[model samples]
Target chain A: MRAPDLIRFARDAAAGNPLRTVLLVLAMSIGVASVVVLTALGDGARRYVVNEFSSLGTNLVIVLPGKSQTGGFNPGNAITNTPRDLTIDDAQALLRASAVRRVAPLAVGTSEISVGGKLREVMVAGTTAQYIDVRRLPLAQGRFLAEGDWRRGASEAVIGAKIRDELFGANPALGQLVRIGDRRFRIIGIMASTGQGLGMNTDELVLVPVSLAQAMFNSNTLFRVLVEANSRESIELAKSQATAILKARHEGEEDVTVITQDAVLATFDRLLGTLTLAVAGIAAISLAVAGILVMNVMLVSVTQRTSEIGLLKALGATGGTIRTAFLTEAAMLSLAGAVLGFLLGHAGAAIIRQLYPVYPAYPPDWAAIAGLGTALVTGILFGVLPARRAARLDPVESLAKR
Target chain B: MMNEPLIALSGVERVFQLGDSEVHALHQLDLRIDSGEYVAVMGPSGSGKSTLLNLLGLLDRPNAGTYRLEGRDVTTLSPEEQARVRSERIGFVFQSFHLVPRLTAAENIALPMVLAGTAPSERRKRVDQALKDYGLTNRAGHRPNELSGGQRQRVAIARATIMQPAVILADEPTGNLDRATGEEVMRLLEELNGKGVTLIVVTHDAALGARAQRQLRMEDGELRQDSRQCAPRT
Candidate 1:
């Protein structure tokens, strides 16, 4: 039969069974929608992780005294009770490597810092002036601490956007006195808002020179190091060289952990990719079930229209024609369902945007195409047996039945 | 009898298995029909009238027989070949009319041409003539449900005759119609016969049977009698 005639046949058949058509379309559409929405969510999470990593500066690597079981540089993994030691000496040795450009030894604590009567318990980071270069934060006010701050042990402080708000209430000028814990310091500058990075607010911290923080708190040991590569090209080399230097400094004991930005981002990438496949697998099960639904519907349709099949055969319609007519109905049902499902999937992604801190990402074009294609192919594949049964029905016996 | 018969069945036997018993629907029946002959098959309900008609129409195959259409052995033809023969040489009208309900009158009439891959222009020309000849031009756009029983039967007749086949087998074509409508349909079939189309009617109505120039009577699956009502005009 010609294309237009077959289409008309499909349209008439579907019109004849509106309730079945609607139900089958709805079922297949839901399968497509679930696939699209799931893939979009996975894409959204990937973007979220990338944005968070970019906020911390792409070339920076975070160093830990040792690895925690979680594989991150958590401060709670200190070796106070153990005899094994990893220290500021390792950070200095890593800095001496040719591939390394700049490094910041950060000592962080959540403590009370006061300016006049206003006091806030905020995160305090102790590092050097290069910490600003390694990170992308720029000074919005007075100058940050020079080498003098670390060498002379000057009590100088730089508060982030959120900390400056709570302490100084906006105008954080160069020459303001602030007390951090037990010692007094000068609020030299305010860092621009870096927004939320790595699932935490960077804008809510106060940063000070490492020596000043150590002197003020009466501690001689350095904190965990933040190492920076010379450029994007040297990142992997820098990571390896730094790991080697830290390894040598610890008498070849690989206690200190060196984690690059690439490694962290890639973990999330692999995790998200696998998660997407898992979700697709789950949706495939639903698609299989929907295909079975199509098979069942087609079987019932064939049984109910037995005499019509007989009549069509009697009318000199080829077996191929009869089979194609029924299969066309199934394919049209699934194709319509796929289109509706794609629309609903976009709506579902919009809902995800409202629920998440990050905006949901659009699913790739292939997702939509594959979603619809799968539905169409599945309908044809599953509708074949029933269509063949219809085509092969014995006209004499069929007419004799009723 | 010098002109060759359009259809011939020799020793045609049809058997069916009914659970544990074998029933013979047509028993060694021999029959011949010629072009332009109007014949009626009359029998009781279980007398194999429809079976003989079905075999002649190429809708069924005999268990043990030699059936020929236009001197060719049609009983040995493949099903597809038989379908081709039916499409080209025979037309059928059923008791229920068998008009596809979803199709319009014109579509139902055009279906045979469509199946045969007739050119659109030619189908249009022939369908227009069939519609006009059957007095169905006004009801061309109506579905089977929208048309009366008689109108639907007219559409069915138009469909059957659109190919202008040599033979038309009608299985009780007026069975569902009122007497007036039945007579009108019978007249149409007789008119086709007048135009040289071999017409075969299967009916239980003796009155309808009496209109045929020849009548074949059956009882208990056997051909009981064959009589000429009058000499068929050459």
Candidate 2:
């Protein structure tokens, strides 16, 4: 038969039974929609983490004072204690590496800050003037600490946006004296509001010079070191150079961990990428269930339409033609369902994007195409049994039924 | 000189197995039908008249037979080859009219031509002519349920002859209609036969059988009598 005629026949047959067709299409569409929406969520999480890390700094490397016993760096290792202290001398030694552009030695401690009869416990981060440039932090008011002697402590502090708001309210806080722990320092700068990074809210921090913070905390050990590579291509070179320098400074012991920004992003990327594939596989089970539903409904249709099959055969339709006609009907229903599912999944993803607003919950292109392709293939594969049965039916017996 | 037969069958046997017991539906049947002949097969129930009609229509395969159509050994042809021959040379009309209830009258009439892959324009032309010839022009868009009994029968006949087959096999063609509608349907079949299309009608109605130019009576899965009559002018 002509292709148009065959399609018309299949369409009419499907249209003849509205409820069955709708139910079949609904099942298939639900299967496809679940695959798309779930994968969107999985991939969305991966992208969110990657964006968060990229915002910290590009071509950046972090140095923690502890040796991570595990080979790879885990985020949890940031809190572990080390066998040796990483001081300002270790931070300065990293600059000798050809690939290392700058280094900021960080001494973090919690202290009570009292300003104009207002006292609040805040996180204190101590580093050099280069800390601003290396961490890509912006200042909201006044100037940061000047480049001065690393050994002689400076009595100057930079308050975070939240501290300035809380302590000084609407009044100017720059050039005001704030007492931190047992010492008083003049507030030289106020930092812009950076919601949160790593585990600390930068908006709630108080920045001081490294030597002063080390004195206030009664320790000469540094908590972390932030390193910036000269170029993107030099990140790996900078990481190894810092490791070698730190090992030499710590008496031939590699007592500190250096991790590149790319390594962390890649770990999260691979972890979440696998998770997306796993969820997609689970969602594909629904398609198989939908395939079974198609097979069951088609079997019933074959039984119900036996006389029609017989009539077509009596009109000189071959077995292959009958099979093709039934399969065409299946493909049409599946394709319609897949299109409906595509729209529904995109709408669902859009809703998620709107709800979170931070993450772009768009399903991957390959996932959408694979969902549709699998739906079609599964529909046709399941259609074979019923179609073959229809083709093999005895025309004499089938026509007698009517 | 004798004209070559359009259909010939010899030593035809059809057996149906019912739980290890074989029942012979047709046994040692021999028959020949020429083009343009109007033949009626008449028998009581269980005498296998329907079975014989099905075999002649190629809807069923005989277990042992040498069946030839247009000098071709159709009994040995593959299933696909048989379907091609059926589409090109054979047509069937059933007792129930068997009009696809979902389709319009025009689509029903064009079904055979569509199966034969006839060009759409030619199919349209032929369907239009069939509708006009069957006196169903006004009802071309109506479905089977919307049509009257005689109209449905006319549509079935139109569909059967749409491919312009050499033979038309109809089994109890008017079984569901009133006597007047049945007579009208039979007249239509006779008119087609008069135009040189071979027509075979299977019926238990002796009066209807008498109207055909040739009649075969069956009993006990065997042909009991074959009779020929002169053409009756209506």
Candidate 3:
């Protein structure tokens, strides 16, 4: 038979049994939609994490003071017990590396800042004048701390947007003296309002000179050392150089962990990439279930239409033709279900995006194609047994039944 | 009529195993049917009339036989080749007027041509003409359930002749209809035979069997008589 006629025959058969067709299509489409939506969610999480990490800075490396023996670093390790301290000397020493562009030594501590008798506890991040450029932080008002001797302990602070808004309100707060941790410091800059990122709300932080924070806190151990590479190619070189310099400064003991930003991003990238595949695999199992459903339904349909098959055979249709006709029916159902599932998955993803606009919950092209392709292949593969059965039916026996 | 026989069967034996004991459906039967002959095969139930029809229609294979169609040894042909021959050279009308319930009369009539891969335009033209020839043009769009018994049988006749086959094999062509409708259907079959197309009708009704130009009577899986001549039964 011609291709169009075969398709028409299959279509008419499906139309004849609308309930069966709907159930089969529903099973197939649900399987495909789950794959699409689940993969989209997995991939979306990966993208969100990657974006968050990239937002830290480009070609950046982070140096944590304590060496984690397990080689796994967590944000809580910043304040953990350490055998040695990474101070301003180590930060200054890193500038000697040719690949290193700038270094910012960070000292983190909680302090009560009182302005006009109004006191609020805030997270204080202390760093040098170069910290502004290294962290890619923008200033909303006034200049950042002036470049000066690292040991002199300059009394200057750059408060976050939220801190400034709360402390100063409508008044101009730059150049105003605020008492932080029993020390007076002039507000030299106000940071632009950047929302929460990587577990830190930058808008609520108060930046101060590292020398002053170390003196006020009565400690010389630095919390973190943020380093910038000269270029993208220099990131690895910078990491190794920073690690060597820190080890050398700490009596040849590798007491700190120096990790490039790309390494962290790559780790999360691989982790989430695997997660997407795993979910897709789990979702593919449903396709197999749907395929089995197709087989069962088609087997029943063959039994119900035995007489019709006999009529076709009596009308001179070959076994091959009958097989092709039934298979065509299967393929049509799966193709239609796949297309509907594709649209449904996108709609589901769109709903997720609408609920959480921060994440782009878009399904990858490969996932969509794989889901549809697997559905088609699975439907056709499972259809073989039933089609073969229909083809092998004894026409005489089939006709005799009627 | 052509000199060469259109259908020739020799020592055709068909056996069926019903659990243990074997039933010989067609016992060493030999028959010859010429082109354009109107023949009736009359036999009681269990007399192997249907088995003989099935073998002649290529719907069943004989356990032992040599059957020839148009002077070609069809018994040695593959199932696919036999199906091709059946599509090209034979037609069938069932006692129940086996029209596909989902299809209209027109689509039912066009089914054989569709199976034969005829062009859509040609199939359409021929179906239209067949509908007109069978007086079914007004009922072309009606499904089998909506049509009267006579109309349904007319549609079946239209479908049977749409392929323009050399022979039409019908099993109890009027068994499900009243006498008036039965006569109408028999007249249609006779008209096709009159057009030089061979017609074979299998019926248990003596009246219907007597209407054919030649009569074949079977008993106990064997041919018992040929009314065309006082010839010895094979």
**Which has the higher DockQ value, candidate number 1 or candidate number 3?**
3
TM-score of chain B of 1: 0.97
Candidate 1 lDDT by residue in tens digits, B1-234: 457678888999999889999999999988888877899999999999988887887778899989977888999987777777877788888888887777789988988777666777898899889888988888889989999989988988888898888889998999999999998998888888888899999999999999889999999899999998776554
TM-score, chain B, each candidate: 0.97, 0.96, 0.96
Per-residue CA lDDT of candidate 1, range A194-216, in tens? 66677446688788887666665
TM-score of chain A of each: 0.80, 0.85, 0.85
lDDT of 2 at B107: 91
Model 3 RMSD in Å is 4.8
The residue-by-residue lDDT of candidate 3 on A332-361, one tens digit each, is 999888888889999999999999998878
Q: By the TM-score metric, which is better: model 1 or model 3? A: 3
The lDDT, on a scale of 0 to 1, for candidate 2 is: 0.90
Ranking by DockQ: 3, 2, 1
**Model 2: per-residue Cα lDDT over A161-227, one tens digit each:** 9999999999999899999999999999999997756666679999999999999999989998999
Each model's TM-score?
0.84, 0.89, 0.89
Error of 3 at A116 (Å): 4.0
lDDT per residue for candidate 2 within B1-234, as digits (tens), equals: 156688898999999998989989899999998888999999999899999988888888999988888877888888788888888888898899999999999999988887778899999999999999999999999999999999999999999999988999999999999999999999999999988899999999999999998999999899999999987744
Reference-based lDDT, residue A220, model 2: 84
Q: Evaluated with DockQ, which candidate comes out highest? A: 3
* Model 1: DockQ vs. true structure: 0.39
